[model samples]
Target: MGGNLQAEPGGIASFSISVRNTGNTVAQHKLTCASGHGWPVELGPSQSSTIDFEPLDILEFLPMQVRLRIPPVTNGSPPAGEVDMITCTVTSSNDPTFSHSEYANVTVSELKVFSTELFDLQGNPVGPEASALPITVETGETVNVSMSITNIGNIEIPLSVKLQSANTDWGMYLVYDGVIEYDRVTFNLLPGHSTTVQVTAIIPLSTFDGSQNAFSLTTRLDEVGTNQFITNGTNFLVGKLLGLSLESSGEKVQATVGAWSQYSLWLNNTGNGALNLNWSTAEPPPGWQFGIDSAPKSIDKLVSSEVSFGVIAPNLAAVGDIEQSIRVRVIGTYYNDSVEVFIDLELTVVPTLHFGLELAPETSVHDLPRETQGQIVVIINNLGNSPGGGNLSAIIVDGEGVEDPEWSLQYEHSFDELQPGEEISVIISVTPTADAGSGLRTVEITILGQADEGVIVTTSEVLSLGVTAESSTTAFDLSSIVSTEVFFSIVVLIPIILFVVVRRMRSSAKIYDDEGESLVAPGVHTSQENISERRAAALMEDVEKEDDVISGDISQFEIQAALVQSIGDLPPPGPAPLPTGLPPAGLPPVVLPPAVMPPAAAFSSSPATTAQDITVNIDDNAAQGGVIGSEQSSSEPMPEAGQQNVAIAGMPPVPPTGLPPGWSLEQWRHYGAEWLQRHSGK
Candidate 1:
């Protein structure tokens, strides 16, 4: 048998083989088939390795079918274009060399199969076939991957390669040989051949830690209507990134010498992970101190913590603005690297002055009498940051706003400089004169200082110092008399003196006209000269009767004396004759000796002329210049004793007494004249 057959992988190759009894007849023959490629071959329907045929059955040409199986690709199938031959043998059962053989050919066709593998640039397998593990990479790092694609098919094909990424912002590319292919690459591959491709992936810095991304390589035939063949992807894990920040609100700080100052700083974790941190500060200059508070050992992402730094300058540090540098270092608790921040701070020191003035508690006020001296104590303090220089002044001010020439105020206390927290006392001797008379006064005390900036600082306090009217040296001060008894005596004596003055005033008011007639009431019956003559004659008759009895009473003598004195002062009646045997009307009366007169006999006899016989007139000479009562004419008959004179026209009724209190004869005469004229009918 000679035949040709074709089969695909894992398919069957079938053909027919012919055998004839060309040898002597009636003998039995056996049939058998062998494959050249060691594949299984079957000869007949019995499916035995060898089959026997009879001579009668082989009389004519016998036809037999042979079947050959092609091997699968996974089981080591032959390559494309390879051929396999099958040989069938016919032999006599009894003879070993009496056989005839026939051959057939089997050809393998094209079979399409593919495989892929992945690895890093260092040849570490990281593909699906190798457990499909993910690749870990840090942010901002580049990764190179190798992709190997194998064609396990029986024929050649055009293949294309492409790289894909899960994120658009990630940079990915495909490469062939040594040249870069932007998105995809194409090439031809023979059966059972393999090719390598490079995949580049650039991780961006903005990627977050622990974020997952994927990159895949797709391989397919470059043919129309071909679906995507194979896609092998691997995950990219983003590693953790650590970040830190240190800052403050201000760089410069103010401080004074020998004083502690504190500053604040903010420490923040700005990265995408938690961190354990330690902080420290640099050493300070000589004689300066620096300190820092305990900081947090662990911090979470996006969290902030506050830290404090304290500093102090030495006592001898220079004044004015000074600068200092401070450095802060922060280190990770798990790492050795550190971050540093610097700050330049300023410290200020200047001279200042503050003054305080206070009066001593016990000596705040003084009660000084007139013509006496007193002392006032004032306390002054320098309440400032530095040394100060100034002067002190004091003055006495009267609350009543009265200035006295005899008042004196003197003090001698001054200083050129004074240190801080120092105090001093000053005495101001105040002497008030006798004329600086009484009431409240004040001692104004002031202290002034100058600062380094030429600014004035002053303080003042007002103290009360009273001046009493009492005098220490003067024995008797009339001005100091304030007794209730003396006041009452002065008030009672004033009315008695006023009464005497009023009586004398009335006596001086008498008036006489040119004819010696008193300027009395116009309707008066008597003239002033006639009344004087009647009074003188009546007084002389009383004295003569007393002399006949020779009364020794001193009261009678006093009466005679008073009569003598009163009549002697009156002007002599004008050109009138003297009554016979009587003394001249102007002559003074004779007074008997006191030894000859007896007190009991003086008032024993009652004279014919009583006090009622006498008539009196009152006058206000300053206003009217006339008396206010009536008088009898020289031709009128004399009224008898114990009888009143006849009532004249317009004359008022007179009192029984000679004169009323505070009334004079002239005033009574003028008034009586006017009264008689108005009441002439009555």
Candidate 2:
């Protein structure tokens, strides 16, 4: 027989047995199975389910093996001390009903389940992020801690929990209720089940407001190993600590040159603790004279204060437009906590120019007959420190009748090159057209000026002028001549009528007393031949007299005015010359023919040609007063303005025009230098 053994639930336990006929006689034996076995019995010798009537000779021994199977357990595995029964029987084949029986006990072994988790009194889970353990609590306050213990082993087990800490200074105790104070808590559990326990902790009035590590230790009832599975460390933040913040009034300021300015600076503390800041100002211009007024180095929490700074600019601190900046720096206790701010300042300066116009004698009015010419002089000046440049233009702004294009205005002039304190005279000329009506005219002379790079300033003035019409064939008044004829006829006819009426009434009106009546018919002509000779004597004496100088009301106009107009047309229609101012009758009229252009010759660089060979001879006779002859009618058209030819050989400039000419090269150079000037100006 084998001693009892141990096995888990639903497991097999095997043992060996010996059977023999110990009484010294032939015997038959049977082997069979019993309850508490894992599988059916299998005998080795016959490979049968059971042993039946096997012969056993005297003094012979037979060995057999037997097996018992353990039944399954449902709710949990059996405890180590738990046991079950297994029985076996051997019966005699002969002499039936004679048998022997045997019984054995089997025990099972298992491990205990042990696990734990934590929560709050409200049944909410607690972990490191919740900061539930080692919490900061007021003195004499008790807090309930909820924890779950789960059985994870295959058998029932009980757990012992205790508060444990490596630091001796932490003063707290684990409690089960109001009275059950202990170092640990105990609970029992079954396999695959759990139980929750409320663990209380108390803080003494002497506990410090700092950090401490708290944890729990658990041990199984049947195992010697321990687990430190519950652990956490927390920080208790409370009471007062140092903190700080900073602020300033503004960031920018504007100022002017040669002046002083002040800024009201403010600082504020936004934290719950006092702050101490060290502040300094940056260097300014030498005479800018920067100063900070009574700045405080310390400030209380939630408080604000003001600081002022000023920049006293010297008279010559800045002369041009510019910008500058000043900086203020504040240092705190820590390197990263410092605050530095900047204050930006600006300064400026500018220059000016004045322009004016003076029409000499203000208004120079001229009285000129129609077809006569005159001039007015004007001056423009600049009186400021700055030099100026601009353009000048003349406008015939107003008048009564139509302005004659032939002689209305000569030219517009410019004084753009005037310097400071400098004056320039522009000559304006007028040639009253031959048929112009009588009236007073006003003309506006405008000077549009600019100074210092396109700054616009303008000024203008009005000039008064007048014109008187001349009596001639083109503008003659026939009514005045008719009135003269009527006056003469009435004077003569009235005397004749009175004389005839008186002669009829008295019958004797005129009785001539012929007493020595000399016949001299108002100094009458002597003999016919003598009167003819006398007329010839008078004409000779008149032609011999010298020509007198007579300047018109508008003098020296046509010759002085630099007016360039197309001269292809003849003089306007007018009357014949007066007998008193006429030239001598015997001279032949001198006429100059137009020049023919040589092949490919331009006036600028043309070489000598056939036209240059044609010579002209002016008469030695002095120029006498000549009337504008009736416009000589011809079928041939006059030359165009650009095609007119000048400088023919041996031709003196008509009427000795302009400054008298000199034969020297220097004189010619000066004269011709301005020849192209008129063509190029605006």
Candidate 3:
């Protein structure tokens, strides 16, 4: 059997045991102890024995023996102060055979005490001067704190380390623990080797701003089967926060009128920073105006600069200068500033009259008929700005260059303001006296102003007038009547004289033959004798018996022969008559019929000479009238005597006159034809 025992320092311990093999056998046995715990003992076969030990202040060792026994073996427990024990035996059961037995003994003792030393994962000794781990971190960042746990003591010891946060709200935590057990980690150290441990913590956004925030790290060490030890660290930070301005100006100057003028003003800026300004001017008022003289001035980066006219700073005071001037004598109130300030200049206002006139339907008349009326349109255009208040007087001069007091016409008008370029129209009617002579006439329009004491401004134009005499129907004097009668008597008598002479000449020519010998007055060559003879022949022809006459006393053939003989000569006499009943030579054939005579009583009072003379005078007058009116009037002469001839000629015969004063032959023919048709009808 073997045994183990424990004891405190300076302690004595003992143990006894008995072994018996009831079967008849022989046995062998041995005894042992651990190295530090010594034992003095012997063992015999089939025999049991007792062992004894003394506790040492230092650790001790012990060994055990094994035993063998025959059947029916027996055993016993170790004595007090033993930690453990073991025993063994072997034997034959049937007969008393050989047997063997072994046993072990152990002693308990106290270990020597020593101080512990710490080391890191690198196996480096961690002395009492070791410092806590340091860490730096930013906000919202996590940092890991790594540490090693080691045993620097000469004895075998179990150790452990722990990690924690001083500020729990700073997001501190443990990342790893080197100890596999609880606070009591099992470890053996030779005063050098070590194991690493790590702890981590997270920093949050709320940890800091533009200022510092702090946190702490804590670590603890634990001895095997003992209490804990602790250490700590601290960290801090600073924070920074992030910053943004916005500004403008107003307008100024103006101008007005009269003559020439000038004005000025300023522009200013009020803002956080300086500004660049650009400006220009619009066209100015009626007669006077203002303008920007030069370009716009600029200011630099600073609101105030010497280069500019004025400093424009934030809420700073500023002032500008304005110069104004004028040239003409201005009349109305002049405005100088935005606030009411008026100034008037010395000047004058004048009033005058300016006007013009035009005649409508422009024409001229040398002299107008008596009681003639004419229309005269006068356009009086006012060429001035002011109104013209005036009286108008029109005087008409006669055609004889004389002014008629009764021929004047006049009118008046009081006009309101006739603004620039305004006009008025007037129409005048005039009638001239019947006695107005023929020449130029004048109509003068005098415009007199009411305001100027009747001072006149005259404008005149001329019209020509023409006059002609009128005809009279009845009014006459005795002298004019007598003179006109005489003139008519002379005109009649001259033609009558001409006709008588022509008749006498024609009679003479007809009585003479082609040889210039009178047919009836044989050998008498005097024209007077020839006329007497023609009269005698005409009378003889008429005396032929009335019964012998055919187709009246004168036939158309005879009339034609007479006309031809009167103008020139007849054709030569024809051949002698044919046998039987032909006409005689040079005579037209006669056609006879039964003749009828007038009653003897009807013929009783008819004188043959009277009838013959009458017929002769008629024939002479007819032939002379036709030829004289046709030709030869100038050759005829007036008769101074011979009343019988004049009486026979009847009405003294119309004179062989030239054509009536203005009448032509063609006109005579027209009248003659009309007369013939009328007479023939009768």
Candidate 4:
């Protein structure tokens, strides 16, 4: 064991011992130590103790640290630095008393790496750790610090020390103790040597951090590196540090170009002493102005203060990031060293949006007409601001029973952008069916949104409409039908077609002359022979009165009336229809007088021949007597004194002769025989 230790009275010194197993086999050994103090010896400064080693691998060294404590001198105590023999014995576990002994030449000395004095720059003594150090100063102040380092080894060692600080302005240097030469130097001293050196460290200002980090001083020996004889450390931070920070500096501020804004800044002095700091703003945007809210002079340590500022952006500040900074610098010559704090003022510029969206109708409520479409105008106003663009559309509010295809709505409007206070108009057209009953109709108009405009559509509102039912008619409700072409084809066109067909059919029928040759009908020549042959053919056709009434033929009725008079004057068959205006064949109609003249008077020479020629007239006067009345005269000539005649049925008898001045005597017998025989069915 090799160690040189120092101890004060009633103190202890420590040393280490290495036990190497040189044998090839693994062995177990028991370690024991004995000293001449005649007390229990141990590896840890005890007078007597047992140290059992575990199984030792081959060629491995099992090292143990042993300590020696020296008691104060008594009547029988050894003097200081007197040699004490500490014999450490190791015995193999397999052999009894098979032991080996090693001796430790221990001096009764306390741990004394340095026995010199240490002083600070103010001539005050300093301690050995981060606890006791040179006095602290305020921020931005350079501090003078001095300390000494001693070489505790017997051989000479190279010495160097550095101040560990991140501050660029902090300075530190050292010099050999008790020498006027202040330049840095290293010396190799003789054995059992000791030397003193002085050191200086400059503390930086901005170090009042809560992360438990501070500027420190460490020493280094050239030969032994940083271990062994170079284990000197000192913490330069005293009670607190000078620090300044703005609480609101971490977040960004938003504004538009040409707009002014204000911000509240909080400054905190987290140090233990009074502080003096000077701050300024730098790199502001062009044409912009900046001002402090409430600037104070200084701050006491550990105290927090508040400050406010206003920044007015220029009318030409570009729309992007504006790089700016706030610098807080401090210098202290009293308690804490110098500090410099910087916070960036990142100004983000954007466009101001003050647009307004609304949907207003021309009227509050719309009253729609039945069976027709209605329209309303909606006003869309662009109460604009800086700049933005959006779209506007209309939405119909769905009401109960309003889901029919007959009810419809339509509209679409879009404005890319508008000037300040610009106005726009839109129209919403609504259509209702004919069957739309009396009720209310609701529609909603809304402003639609475009992509990335940041405009929410809150302009939806309902538009109500009152409707009325249609009038009652025999017409059918064809609202569910596709069209009205089918109704016109059946109701109107077919009736017109039937009237044309009946008029054409009546014009094609033949009409006969049957007014006993006095009144001639149409479709006859003026020749009497042609008239007689046509008349005979018309009579032989057997005209029926039912045919006249059913076929709506007026000329057919005249034919039936003439056949009735041929039997006898039977009151002209109850007024047969006479063709008026133009005839059905487009001929001029013939008009007859109220009486018929006695025919053949001019044609026959005697009254008997005229009486035989007397025939019933096919006119209204034929219903009269021989003198234009219904009665027949008795003093009448027979049909040429021997001709046979048949009397008509439903006829009155003839009157006696000597009738009137205009009477024919033989005409009475003609009427009697014909009227009686026709009535008797002969």
Q: What is each predicted model's overall lDDT from 0 to 1?
A: 0.60, 0.47, 0.35, 0.49
TM-score to true structure, per model: 0.32, 0.22, 0.19, 0.22
Taking all chains together, the TM-score of candidate 2 against the true structure is 0.22
What does the lDDT come to for candidate 3? 0.35
Worst 10 residues of 3 by lDDT: 240-249
lDDT of 4 at 151: 43
**Candidate 3 on 473-495: residue-level lDDT in tens?**
23532222233356588778999
Which segments of model 2 are wrong by more than 4 Å?
Answer: 2-14, 19-32, 36-83, 89-101, 107-159, 166-182, 186-195, 199-214, 220-682
State candidate 3's TM-score: 0.19
Candidate 4 global CA lDDT score: 0.49
Clashes of 2: 3
Residue-by-residue lDDT tens digits, candidate 2, 269-293:
5333455677777777665566667
Clashes of each: 33, 3, 57, 51
Please, what are the lDDT tens digits per residue for candidate 1 over residues 349-385? Answer: 4344565666666552344765567767777677555
If the candidates were sorted by their lDDT against the true structure, best first, what order would they fall in?
A: 1, 4, 2, 3
Across 358-463, the per-residue lDDT of candidate 4 in tens digits comes to 4455543344565566665666544323444455554333334335455666666665654435666666667666555333445555454232354322223233
The true-versus-predicted C-alpha distance at residue 444 of model 2, in Å, is 93
